[model samples]
Target chain A: MDMIKIIKPGLLTTIQDNGRIGFQRYGIPVAGAMDDFAFRVANILVGNDEHEAVLEATFMGPIIEIGFDGFIAITGANMSPKLNEKNIHMWRSIEVHKGDQLSLSGAIEGLRTYIAFGGGIGVPEIMKSKSTYVRGSLGGYNGRKLMEGDEIPIDASKSKAKVGRYISPGYIPRYNNNNVVRVVLGPQDDHFSPEAIETFLNSEYKITAEADRMGYRLEGPKLTHVKGPDIISDGIVSGSVQVPGHGSPIVMMADRQTTGGYTKIATVISPDLPIMAQMGPGDTVRFKKVSVEESQNILFEYEEIISNIKYRVENSFIIQETDKLYNITIKKL
Target chain B: MYEKARFLPAGDKSLIIEFGDSISPEINKKIRDMYLAIEKSGLDGIIEMVPTYRSILVSYNPLNIIYEDLCHKLRELEDNLNDSGSEPAKVVEIPTIYGGDYGPDIEFVAQHNDLSVNEVIEIHSSRDYLIYMLGFTPGFPYLGGMSEKIETPRLKTPRTKIPAGSVGIAGKQTGIYPIDSPGGWQLIGRTPVKLFDPFAEPPVLLNPGDYVRFVPIDEKEYKYILKQVEENKFTVNIALLDK
Candidate 1:
C-alpha cells in the first residue's frame, strides 16, 4: 500500500533510521538521521521500534498525503506541520486514515524535522539500512531524496498509542542559530601545533553554505598544522573535526565516508551531534573543550532522557490532549 | 599502550591505535593480527572495527564500555595477540580483460613509462598486490607493492562516473573501483568479477591483509564471468598462498 505520496518535496527529504552499522570496515558509511534524538523521539511517539525509519526533512518538509490508517508524530525542527489544511502539533502523535493530507512549511527553529509514520517506512533495505546516502547512491527510497508523485511504502502501525501521546515541552530541545557545541580533542590532535589547537578551541566558526549530511564545513580562523594537513587514510566517525590543507574545519556527519585522508584535530561528542545537526548555514557556533569523562557524563544523561520518555506519555503527553484539544478555525487558503 | 603503538581518542565512542605511520606488510600484518584477536575476544559493547594500513579504529558503545575500560581490555588483547588461529593469507584471483575500451589508458601508461601495452600488462599482472584496506568507495581496495614500471599520474580531470570493476593505477599505487564513482585514477583494465555486492552476506569481496592477483583473460571469459556474477553463481577463487 502507498503510505505517503509526495505532492511536493520540500527542500531535501529522505528516509532515515538508526543507522547501518557493522559495515564500516567495508568502507560503507553508517548513514542515518543527522538529528538522532529527534529521530528517535518521533519513532517512540508512534510506538515504533527505535530503529524504524522516519522521514527526515531539512529546512523545509514534504507535502505528503497518506493512504493508511495509522499515526504520525513530528519532532525536531518545527515546520508548522498541518493536517488537512489545519495546524497540527509538533512532538505529539495524531491519528489519520487513508487520503489524509499532511504538510510542513518552512522551518522556524531547527534545521531538520522528522515526520515518522506509525509502523515506519517499508522501503527495501540496502545493507540492512533504510537511511539514504546520496553520494554513494546506497539505501533508503531508491538511494535518493523524495521526488514529486513518489509513492512511499509504510509499515502499518502496531502501536496502541492514543492520539494524545506526546512529548512534553521540557523534553523538546530548542535550536538556535548561535549555539555552543562541545568537542573532545584527539586521534590526530598531536598533528597540530599547541597554539593551533588553542586557536581551534577559542575561535567561533560559522556554518558555511557547504553543509549537508556528509559534513558541515565551518569557516573560521585558519588552523595551522605542524606538518602538512595530510594523514594516511583511516576510519572517520561522525563528529570528526577534519582540517584540510586550506585550514578550515569540516565536522564529519552521519552520511560521511568511512575513511578520510585529512588530519582530524578533534571530535564532537555524541550528545551534542543533534544540536550540531540542527544548526544551518550561516549559524555561528563556538567550540568548548571538554574531557571525555565530562562529555560521556552528558551522554549518559541524554540516553537517560530517551529511556524514560516512552512511559511518561498518553495521560500527560505534551500540551496534554486529555484536558482539551486546541480549537482552530480552518481558513480557506 | 605499547612503545610504538599510540592510542588516540576519537570522540567518546571510538579509539584509534596507530602502530606506525607508513604502509608495509609487517605493519599491516600486525594490524590484522591485533584486529583478529580483538574481534575474536567477544568483548562486550564493541560495535565495529576498521583496520586501515597502519591503524585500527575501534568503535564501541560508551554506555556499555567506557573508553578507559575498553582501552584496558584492548591492552590485554594486544599483549595476548597471537597468529595461532589466523588462517594463511589467501590470494583472490581477479580475472580481467585488458586493453581496448576495458583499458583505455593502457597506451597512456605505456607511453609515460616507455613501454608497450603487452609489457604494461606483463608488469601489472606479474605480482600479487597486498590489499592494505578498503576505503574511498565500498570494497575499493588500497593496494600496496605496485610495480614502478606501470606507475602513471592520475587523469588531469577525473571522469564523472567511472564504471565499477575498473582497474586503475595512480602514481605509486594501483586499485580497482568496486563501484561506479568519479575518480582521477588512470584506468588500465576492467575486471569481470564483482568486488562488492551490497545485497550479499559479506557484501565486500576483498579484506585487509588479503592478496589480489590479476589474471588476464580474453573478452569471452570476461563475458562468461560477468554472466555468472549476474546470476549469483560466480564463486570467487580464493586459495591459501604458498607458504
Candidate 2:
C-alpha cells in the first residue's frame, strides 16, 4: 500500500537484488547489484532480507516523494542525500513520513549507490530475481531504469528495529581515486607471455569511462599475448580479467555474458570486488596476484566480520534495555 | 575420443575444465558430456555450469564448498564419466527467409564470397551446423561448421542494431542473433523462430551440442510462421540425431 513517486530519476536508477542465479546456462546474464557489499549492508540496516531488491543509482541519485511512513537506508556511494531540504548521512537507516521529499546529488566518493526500503521494493521477480538486465529487457521495473514520474511500490511491512542504526566504523569501506585490487592468476594465464603477466600485475591501469555493469574496460599497459588472445570460446565468470586482441583487459562484472572468446589472464578475488565496483572513470587500479588459498581466506575473514556484526548489535541493544528497566524499578521502589 | 582435461581456476568461486584447445565436434561433445556428468552427480554448492566450445565453467558458492574439495569431486566425476550413455544430440531445423528487407546484408555476403545469393543460401543450409555454445545474448547460438565457400569477413563498422533471429556469417563462423543487438556479422537470412523468449520455460531454444539446419522459406511462409510463433503454436522441428 506504500509507494514513492519519482520527481526526478537521476542518471540510471534500477532495482537490483543478489542476482539471477541458475540461468547462465541459457545465456541469461546474472544481473545484480554492482556493489554487493553496499547492497547487503543497506538491506541489513533497514531490517530487510539481505537479498532484497534495492534501488541502485549510478553517479547521480533520484528525487522521490514518499506517500507513507517507512524505514530506508542508503549505502555504497556518498551522494549527499537530503530529506526535505535537510542533509542525511550514508551507511545508516533513516525514517521518512508521508509527503517527505528525498533527493540526492552527484556521488562524491564512489560510482554506484544503493537505497533499500524496510520490506524491499515490490517488483515482480523474473527468473527468481529482481535484478535488471537492461540489454535483454528482463527483470526489474519493466526491465529498464527508473524514469521521471514513475511510481515505485514498496512492501507495506513495517520494521521493528529503530532507525538511525549505523554500520560500525571498522566495517566501513574506504573509497578513493586509486585502488590496488587483488587477483588470482587465471583460467587462461598460460596464453599470455610471462612479461605480459608481469605487466598486468605491476602496472597501474585507469578505469575508462566505458565501465558499466557489463564490464570494466581498463586502459593500461598493452599485455602482449604469446599466442593470439583469441581462445576457443569459453565460459566467463564475473571478475574474470579477459584480454582481447587489442591487449586491453576487460574485467567482467555482474551483467557479463556467460561465455566469451578472449583469454582471461586472471580473476579478481570475491572480497575485492567491492573495491572494483566503487571505482569511477579515471580511477587508477593496480593488480596484486594472490594464491587461491589466500583469496579464499580473505573471503572467509570478510564473511566472519559480517556475521559478527548482528550478534554485537543485539548484545548492545539488550544491555541498554536492561539498564532502562533497572532505573524504572528503582524509581518505583 | 575422451581427452585429458586440465582444471584452471576461473576465480576463487569458479573453475574452468579445459577439455581441449580447439573448436571441434569432438571437443564440444566432451564439453556436453562433462556438463551432464557433473549435473547427474548432484554436486552440492554448484551454482551453474556453462558449456562452451572446449571447456565447462563451474561456478560455486565458497561458503558451502571449498575450492579444493570441488576440484577433487569434479576430477573424480570426469574420470568416471560415461560418454556412451549420454543423450544423442538433437537436430533443430530453423525456417529462414533469405535475401529481402529482413536480410539487408545478403548481397554483401554473397558478393564477398564470389557467389550468387541463391548459391550462398544452398551452401549455408546444406550441412547441419553444430551449436558450439550459447552466449553474447540470451539464446544466441554460437554455431560452427559453416561451409568454407560462404566465408565472409565481418563488416568494418558493426551495425547499430541487428534484428533478432538474423542468421549471420562472420569469417568462418555463423550464428543467430537471439536478441536485437549491435553486431558485425554479415546477415544472410532471417529466421522467424523466437530463439529467445523470457516467458518460455527454457528461454533458450537451442543448447550446446545440438545441431541446427537452416530451411529456406518465402516471404509468405515467413509471415505465416511468424504468426504461428506469436500464437505459441509453432514448435521447432527437432529430431534425435543418429550416432
Candidate 3:
C-alpha cells in the first residue's frame, strides 16, 4: 500500500466521503463532501466507486507527493491544479508517477475542490465513513484537518484507461458567484410577515466571511417574522433557510445541527445545494420561490442525469476491459 | 391534549411525528413513549429517529416505504402506545466548579436576582434536569430544568468559540458546550468530563428522557478530577431512577 504525504496544507484540507449517515441520530453531523457531484466525478476518474474517499480542500489546495503510480482527477473548484510545475486540466484523468509533486492553490473558480485517486484515499474509517466531523472528532484521518507530514495511504489499485471521456459541461455543474437559489416554502414560512417573505425572495444577499460547513450567514434586509406561535424544536434539513431572532437568515449546509428552533422560511431544493456549496464569502445570493411540484421536478431531472452517468461508468468499465465498449448498447431493465 | 400523534412529511424520504404544539413535560413523555413504541414495533424502513423537545423526526428509505405509507404505519403504531412503559433511565452525576473564571457569568446572574452565589448553586444542583433533547452540536444536551434566578439572556455577541465543557445559560434553558464551537450562551461554569465521545460505547453521554444532576465541587476537587480525566481514570457516580 503506497501513500501520499502532505508537504503543505494549503488553506484547510480534510479527508471526506459521502458522510456518516447512520450516526445523525446521535447528534453527529453528516460531514461529507460539500459537492457530491464533483466528488463523484473525481472518484470516477480514478476508477473508484463514486462514494470512495477523497480530499475536500477548502478555499485552497494542499501540496502532496504521489506515493504510487496511479490516476487522479480534480473536480469542484478549479483551484489551478499543477503537477510538478505542469498545469493539469480538471474533470479528466491524469497519471501521476511515484514521487510526483501535486499542488493545489486558492479558488480560481469555486470555493471547494476535491482531488480523488485511483483507489481513493485510504484512511481509517469511523462510523462506516471516511468523512471527517471535527466537532465530534470522528472519521477521516482521525477526524481532523489534514496537516503537513500527514501520510495518507493510497490503495495500489490499477485502473485501465487514459484520455477518459469528459463529462459534458451540462453534466458538469457550473459554479456561479451570483446565483439565484430556488427554494420551496417550508412549514414556518407563514411566520414571517408578507413583506419579509417578499424581501427574502427579491433581495440579493451577500455571503459573510463568518461562513462554514454548518451554515452560510447572509447579510440582507432584516426580516421581521410575526410570531404565529412559539415553534417547538424540530429536526432540520440541509439547505433550510433558518431565521434566528437576529432577523438574518442562516442557510444550513451539510454540517448543520440535526435539529433547530429557528423559524425556517424556505428550504432550497436539494439539487441546488451543491451549487450553494461552491459559493464563498462576498458571493451574492438570490432566492426564487418555486412550487412543490417544481422543486420535485428539478430534483427528479438531476436524479435521471445521475443514474445515466452511473450507467455509463458501470458499463464503460465492462466494455473497456472486455473490448465491448461499442458492441454493447445499454438498455434499461 | 392531543389523542394521537400524526406523521407529516419532513422531506421526500423523512416523516415527523409531532406530539403537540407546546413544550409540556407530558408532550415530551408522549414523544418518548411513541419513540419507544416504534422501537418495540420493529418497524422497517426506519433508518434513524431523532427526538427533539416535543417531536420525533423519523427518516426512512422512500424506496422501501413512501412517506404516505410510512405515515399510515405510524398511525397504526400510535395505537400501541397505551402499553408503553416509562422505563428507568441511568442517571449521571456531573461535578461542577462554580463562581470563578470557569463560571464568570454566575455572579452576574446571582446579582441580577439579588441572591448569593451559594444560593444559586444550591438551587441549580438541587433539582434533577431532564434531557429533553440532545442537539445544537454533537453531545450537547438541551437540558430542561433550572432555578428561575439563574435564567439569563445570552451574550449580546456570542464568542467566536467556546471551549468544550463550558456550562452556559440562555434564557430559561441551560446546556453544556460538548465541543469547541461558536456559542452565544452566558457561561456559568465548566465541567471536566467529556459529554460526547464518538469512540465510546454510546457516543452521547445523555439521551432524551435521561436525567442529569450537577454536583458542586471545590477547586481542589476540580483539579483532582481534571488530573483523573487526563489519566482517563474518572468514573461518574450514577443513581438509577425507578420507573
Residues B1-243 of candidate 1 have per-residue lDDT tens digits of 235577888997888988888878988989999898887889999999999988999998899988888888888887777778676899999998898899899999999999999999999999999999998888999999999888899999999989999999999999999998899988889998889988898999999899999999999999999999889899878877875
Q: Interface RMSDs of all predictions? A: 0.8, 1.0, 2.4
lDDT of 3: 0.80
Candidate 3 on A50-153: residue-level lDDT in tens? 89889999998899998898788888998899999999878767878998999998897889999988877778777778998876667889778989999998
Best by TM-score: 1
TM-score of chain A of each: 0.94, 0.93, 0.90
Candidate 2 pairs with clashing backbones = none
Q: Write the per-residue lDDT of candidate 2 for residues A1-333, one digit (tens) a residue.
A: 788898999999999998989888888999899888899888887777788999999999999998778888889989999999999878777888889999998999888899988877888888889999997889999999999999988884655444456667788887998999999999889999899999999999999988999999999899989988888778888899999999999999999988888899999998889999999789999999998888888888878877766544333321135436211111222
Quick one: ranking by lDDT, best first? 1, 2, 3
Off by over 4 Å in 2: A158-164, A313-333, B112-114
Worst 10 residues of 3 chain A by lDDT: A317-326
Which should have the higher lDDT, number 1 or number 2? 1
TM-score of each: 0.96, 0.93, 0.85
Q: Of 1 and 2, which scores higher on DockQ?
A: 1
How would you class the docking of model 1?
high
